[model samples]
Target: MKILILKRDKLGDMLLTTPMFALLRQHFPGARIDVLANTYNAWVIDGNTDVSRVWSYQRVKEGGRIHWRAAFAQLRQTLALRAEEYDWIIVANGDASHRAIKRAAWLGGCNLVSYTDAKNSHRKVNHPLEIPRQIHEARRMANLLTPLGISLPEVLPPLRFQLPAEAQTFANQWLAEQGLTPGSYITLGLGARRAKKQPTTEQIIRWTRHFHEAWGLKTVFMWTPGKSDNPMYPGDDETAQPVLDAKLPWLVPFRGPLKPALGLIFNGRTSLFPDSGLMHFAAASPGGVLGFFAETDVSPAPAQWGPVGPRARWLEAPKAVSQLEDASVFAELESLLK
Candidate 1:
């Protein structure tokens, strides 16, 4: 059997579907399970064992004009996929109106499974499942497999992100240079998609001191690597500067590519982050993860997108994350650490 799973989305969204890949492998051990991921999030599944192959494509940014060369390349890839004659094509994204489902239908798969909402009631999905109003994204992805007799477990497995051997080596060397060892420190990610979701510099300093005094663990601060002015992918250079300027010996600053950064997070005792891609990466690690999310009525609740794992925990503030009291934040941290 051959299957195609479409999850060409953001980093967090791609990570959420990892459990479904594992379940598919277990159910059909010999089946070839491939994934259609985008260039941005394909790294999440680089070393994943369950996926037979990963096909990646670039996504044009919203409102950006599509280049002819890129369009032709996409068309070629789509035609190739249609030729594969997959037994099943599952649109693993939670959104009912995701364009990937329409592409799946065009692929002429023998069986197509996807979500159906009021807006997408007419989409051609052979096995249509209504989008669940209240469920973790991982569970929502798992629901797509029900048509194949794969049932959701009471407890979904944690997100999966395997570090490559090279990255592990780099992490080990970097830690040695800094006189640190695995599980001996904590990581604090300083980047969030929106500035409002991040904790203030003073708050970060307080947290660092608290962690050091309470538990002898040093803190490693990681942030996005480019200037905020970059049009393509704005980063947190300005946001991280104040914390870095403090020059606290115990507060190590890290700015690099995603893989090595992930390696460092995986080796830490635990990690703290705002609601961002790094938070999702940390959730996949063996160490505990704590995420601070902003609550907004217009967006999906933190309960849906927040980290999911035995060791993952999150706190939500009604307005901006700055509104969360230090006492409440520390209390949640105490519970998570214990």
Candidate 2:
């Protein structure tokens, strides 16, 4: 069967959806599974084993979000997707990706698309996230296709991607050029979809340099577009923007493709990121590690959002072991050095 999984979100969001790719492969065995994502999130699946193809959509400005241009692109993609005669199209987004699916179906001539009718957009779609049983977003996606008489073993599937041998070699060469080694390095995610979701800029600087000095961990800072310039994605709409928008101006303006941000999470020794998509990617990578904090907690104290499985040790704190106190994080990072 031909399958299309649609996920139009940030990098980490796409990464989480990837685990479902593994599950789909196991259940269908011979299905031709493909994914549709925003341009920024497209590369996350570049070397993924389970997915057979990728389709990318442009991230448009809020003013012209679903304008004629977007409509034309959607129409074209949907028409192409229609040619595939997908036996199933699982939209991996909650309400957010549903919009894309609706457009695609309108354009593609396939009306039977599935996605999490998530709380975030339930009112719009008016469809409850039924099959997935309304659990984690990842689980919900897996649930969507389960109705098609597919089920995998009870064990959770993993998200994975292989660096092209040359890419791996190039990455190693890049590391060597920086005089860095994997164990002796710490990577910091300096950008987020929401600026308030991040630890302060001063915190990032202190944490990275501190770890470098105390643990001898070389540093890598993930950068996004116009971050130093505008520092925030021009939000949903100025009037509809979250009020905290005024408080967070130092973050990345994030108008470029999100691929670079997703790419940033893979190499870190431990990530200090909020509960966003990159955190999921870092947690899911072959041997990835992260320090995750909950975005649910909006306090000034940084939260640690780490890998949830054997590959990570999730750290949650009002204890203040932050990306700011780099020296302290360096000490904690020692355990992962080997």
Best by lDDT: 1
Residue 32 lDDT in candidate 2: 90
Q: Clash pairs of candidate 1?
A: none
Q: Could you give candidate 2's per-residue lDDT for residues 8-98 as a string of tens digits?
A: 7766566667668888887778889888787766876887879888888776555435556865786677778777776666666644454
lDDT computed for candidate 2: 0.55
Give lDDT tens digits, candidate 1, residues 224-331.
988888877788899999998898878988899888898899899889998877888888788868888875575456778888888888888877778888888777
TM-score of 2: 0.68
Where is model 1 more than 4 Å wrong at Cα?
A: 60-69, 121-123, 229-231, 334-338
After best superposition, candidate 2 residue 334: deviation in angstroms?
4.4
How big is the positional error of residue 315 in model 2, measured in Å on the Cα after superposition?
Answer: 2.8
State the displacement of the C-alpha of residue 53, model 2, in Å, after optimal TM-score superposition: 2.6
TM-score of each: 0.90, 0.68
Clashes per candidate (backbone, < 3 Å): 0, 15
